[model samples]
Target: MPPHDHHHPILATQGLSHRFKPSGRGLHDITLSIPRGQFVVLAGPNGSGKSTLLRHFNGLLTPRAGTVWLDGVPVAADPARARRMVGLVFQDAESQIVGETVRDDIAFGPENLCWSCDAVDAAVRAAMDQLGLTHLADESPHLLSGGERRRLAIAGVLAMGPEVVMLDEPFANLDYPGIREVLRQVVAMHGQGRTILLAAHDLEKVVGHAQRLIIMDKGRIAADGPVVDVLPLVEQYDVRLPCQARLGMSVTSWLN
Candidate 1:
């Protein structure tokens, strides 16, 4: 069974806001709760602050005004603990992999956590098997396909044993099969009860895969609700909806 409400608060935000330079370009008055084990998607147009909002969950971007909580720990004051439990995977796969070899890349996180050699090896192996990357264990990460590279990046975070995984546009450079493969890994992780916060544009890829949706417009949350409630807004917002959702809306009338 999937994890339910009893798991406690994995990530939460209160009156959160962000600004860029002299001009503010992110969300404001943002109060949200991401219960443990929820698969949440951040969606909006090109200029939306979806990515900026996600950064607060793990303290990648500091809280602009209010507060951010992760695993019940305040993120604004001391971000280290939350950072360990809430891992972030950037949109670009190449930018994250620091090491040349896949083994080195996978071991990087544990090494940062100061794990012993034996423990690091075990963590890497477990992460590889979990993400179905045991075969690419010794190869160079730069040589892997886009999807494989994504898995590798995620594997590095898993080595840290984080409770929440934040992915920013994970489907950016993937082919159809690669998209399917990466989505499968994400679904599997969510199934295993790890909280997932995804910022994505390829709505089709994340439509059926996500459980919750947070829609942003002009740096503010336009709508936030269960996937069933918010997904149909694609057309209402004059934005593109997933193919399946658009069809459902057209046929079901009530969805509109």
Candidate 2:
């Protein structure tokens, strides 16, 4: 892993709040700071505002009551710049796949940035290699397996070269092997010094990889701290505590 920079937060939220019409399914008074190169996991049950909060990080959802800052600049000031700095991969990878081929999909972001042909090609190749998708470069994204599609979605975001990457429910709908593959890629990204923020309900799948674990309940932050210290109480907030933690064993691997 690269050196950590403690000077300023890469992403910060100050009393951030939002609400959806009729249902009001959104975040409330969320205040937090994520430093550069930190692998953070935002865990919670369904409807806990994990997705909503992740959207706010990149201006996908506007803050109805508070503010979000990206590298000390308000996200509201320049939503486009903030989005460029932070990339989000939705839980349903198929929803984000636009191009017919995997290579074309991965190249979309860089193309939009108006990168030179060589630069776009380089980025696409690098991202595909990173996600183990080079073999499937010519395949149709829609025809890929669940895990392959998920990796393609992540590769698309990585091609844009964002500083921070947020994935919402990345492990959902995947088999054990698929889960492991995604977990491995996530760890590799963190090793490259990219700040990682993944939201998921399955703590056992990612708690071992996270430096900090945050629990959310009813669209609010319930707990935030080191994974070890906070894992014990995760069950109290309706999120499951890793079985190993409950059995008095160390959480050393997600595969376990």
Candidate 1 residue 108 Cα shift, in angstroms, is 0.6
| lDDT per residue (tens digit) for residues 210-246 in model 1 | 7788888888888889888888776554457876666
Worst 10 residues of 2 by lDDT: 1-10
* Model 2 CA lDDT for position 105: 97
Question: Model 1 has how many clashing residue pairs?
Answer: 1
Q: Over the stretch 161-239, how does candidate 2's per-residue lDDT look in tens digits?
A: 9889999999999998999999998998899889999998989888888999999999999999998888988889888
Tell me the whole-model lDDT of each prediction, alpha carbons only. Answer: 0.81, 0.90
All candidates: TM-score:
0.91, 0.96
Error of 1 at 109 (Å): 0.8
Best by TM-score: 2
TM-score: model 1 vs. ground truth: 0.91
Worst 10-residue lDDT window for candidate 1 reads 247-256
Q: After superposition, how far is residue 239 of candidate 1 from its true place, in Å?
A: 3.6
